[model samples]
Structures are given as structure tokens and as C-alpha cells.
Target: MQGATRTPAYAGRGGSRSIIALAGTLITVFIVNSLIGLFAIQYAGDADVRDQTTLARLSHALDTAREAQVAFKIQVQEWKNVLLRGGDAKDYDRYLASFEEQERRVRDRLEALAAAAGDLGLDAAAMQAALADHATLAARYRDGLALFDRTHPASVAVVDRAVRGIDRPMDEAIDALAEAARARAAAIRADLEAARAERYRTLRTVAIASMLVGIALVGAILVRTSVRRA
Candidate 1:
């Protein structure tokens, strides 16, 4: 009878120890999982912020470039209309000045965009080439205006050709750049989304793994205690 009583007491003490050990293991796993989750959240947030900032800058640059292109085109068309109307010399001079001013402003805007692009690690050689083409067109336009001042009938035709030459190539270059910027923005957005998904996956996996470990520890403790009791 005494032996039976002592056996139960011994078994009870062993069960308590097993339960404590299991609890400690569970606590450790919980802490580890919590840390991992926190880190993942932080990383995801940082990536999202960086991607958003880049997208905003790219969008702004594209908008500015497009606006500058439109303004330049309008000026060219106005000059063409003046020449077609056989306007006076003063009118021609005024139109030429206006065209030059618009051209200069567009160039300045392009330069600003290039500077912003440099910060974004963009390839700016295309932009530079486009700008060079624009300069050539401007020079040709100025020459054509000079011919007009001298009463040359072919001046209008030459100016028209020059404007066409510059406008088409400039438009193409701007379109290409805008498309590239949009593609990059799309890629960044996709990457950010993927990162967020991956973080969630990681957290889910950690939570599941932690739960499994806890259950296993509890089962092991219960089993050991049961064996000791038997």
C-alpha cells in the first residue's frame, strides 16, 4: 500500500517537470516567431515606400516632358501658319522670337528632367541625343527665318521641312522615354507586391510551424507523464 502511494507521488513530480519543460520550449518558439514577423513587416514597409517614391518621380518627369513637347509643337504650328499667310516681316520676327522662346523653355525642361532621371539611375543618352536633334532643328529654323528676311520664296518650304524633321524625331524620343518610365513603374509595383506576398507567406509559415511545435511539445509532455503514471 505504501509503495503504491509513493509511486503516484513520484509520477506526479515527473509530470510537473515535463509540463514545465514543454512550456519553456513553447515560449521560446513564440518569441522567435514574433521576432521574425516583426522583421518581415519592417522590410516590407521599407520596400513599399521606396517603390512609391520612385514611381512618383518617374510620373512627374514624364508629365513635364510631355507638356514641354506639346508647347514646342504648338509654337512650330503657329510659325507655319504665319508663314502661310504671307504675314509682314514684323509678324515673322515676332513669331520667330516666340518659337525660339518656346524651344528654349522645352530644352530647359528636358535638362531638369535629365537631372531628375540621373537620381533615379536612368540611361540619359537617348535624352541627350533627342536634345541634340532639337538643337539642329532650331538652327535650321533660324536659317530659314533669315532667308525669309531676305524675301526668299523657298524659306517657308525649308522651314516647314525643318519643323517636320525635328517634330517627328522629338516625338518618337519622348514617346519611347515615357513608355520606358511606365514599364519601370509597373515593374517596381510588381516587385513590391511580390515582396509583400512573400512576407505574408513567411509569417504564415512561421505561425503554422510554431503551432505544430507547440502541439508536439504538449503531446510529448502528456505522453511522458502518462508513461510515468502507468
Candidate 2:
């Protein structure tokens, strides 16, 4: 007698549903982890941008403020030279021209520093006061120079006296501005360091969370596969 052939049963709908659910869970975990990574990257980029901006503003403030101080000193020296060597008309003219050049340089640097401070959302009031003092000093020098021009070789005493009266205050104001700029720069550096540390911490947290999630999802998928096989 011929035996009837039996057909093997198809895989059940329950097994298919289990596979679908596992796939969905894995996809969801991947998406969540990817979002976390992307968010961390974006946050780090934002922090970097902020740090760069702070560094640029601080550099501009400090460097330009110092350069302006040097230029003002040169101006003061030229003022002294005008008093000492202006007996000759040509020497007076040369020294006066040099003084004017230095004045222009100082003004330019001050403007640049003020602009940088403003851009950094800082108060330029202190810098403005220094600029005002500079203007007063320049006016005094101009008056002294004019007096010297009319009474060359004889107005030395008057010019010296005027410069002597103004030099200390003028230097003090410039020094104050530079000191303020230095203080501001130090604060910016601290902020940058803090931001850097924060970014590292955030990245580490995200990495650890992602690793744990990945491990859990993999374990779940392995269990599901084994169950399906069994």
C-alpha cells in the first residue's frame, strides 16, 4: 500500500508578529540614539562658537588697548621732544608731525577697542572715559604746542609745566583702561574653560547612555531571535 505524502506546516502568524515587533523596537532605539548623538554634536558646536567669540573679543580688547597705550606714550615723548628741540623750526615741524601721527594711531586703536567691547555686549563706559581723558590731554598738548610755536626756545618752561600737570592723569587713565581690559579677558578665559568642561561632560553622558541603550536593544533582539528559532 502507497502511503499519503504529508505537507510541512507554514510558519505561524505569531512568529511573523514577533519578528515585526522586534524590528520595530530596534528601529526605535536606533532613532533615539541617533537623535541623542546629533543633539550632543549640535550642542558642542554651539559651545565652540561661543568660546571663539569670547576669545576674539578679549583679544581685540586687550591687544588694541595696549597698543593704544604705547602710541599715547610715543605722543607724550614727542611732546617732550617738541619742548626740548623745537628751537629749530624744522625740528619743531618734524616733532609736531610725529606727535600728530601718534595721536591718530592712538585714536584709531581706542575706537577699535571700544567697538570690540560693544560687540561683546560689554559696557564701553570705562573706555569712553579713557578716550575723554585722551582728548583732554591732546587739547593740552595742542595749546602747549601753539604757545611753543609763537615763543620757540622761550616757552619751554610753560610747555614742560603743562605736560607735567597732565602726564600723570593721562597715564593713569590709559592704565585703567588696560587693566579693565585685562580683567575682562581673564573672565572670558574662565568662561571658555567652563564651557569646554561642560561640553565634555555632556558628550560623556550621551555616550554612556547610548552604549547602555544599544546593549539593551541587542540583548532583546538576541532573545527574540532565539525564541523564534526555538
Per-residue CA lDDT of model 1 for 1-230, tens digit only, reads: 65563456766678788788878877876787778777767877887788788778877876777776776777677667567754576776677677777778778867776777677655578667767877877786666655553366666776566455556767677667666666666776677678778877877887788778777877877787677767
List candidate 2 stretches off by more than 4 Å. 1-12, 121-123, 149-152, 218-230
Say which candidate scores most in TM-score. Answer: 2
Best by lDDT: 2
Q: What local lDDT score does residue 229 receive in model 1, on the 0 to 100 scale? A: 66
Local error of candidate 1 at residue 189 (angstroms): 3.2
Candidate 1: RMSD to truth: 3.8
What's the residue-level lDDT of 214 in candidate 2?
78
Per-residue alpha-carbon lDDT of candidate 2 for residues 153-187, written as tens digits (9 for 90 to 100): 56788767766768778777777788878887898
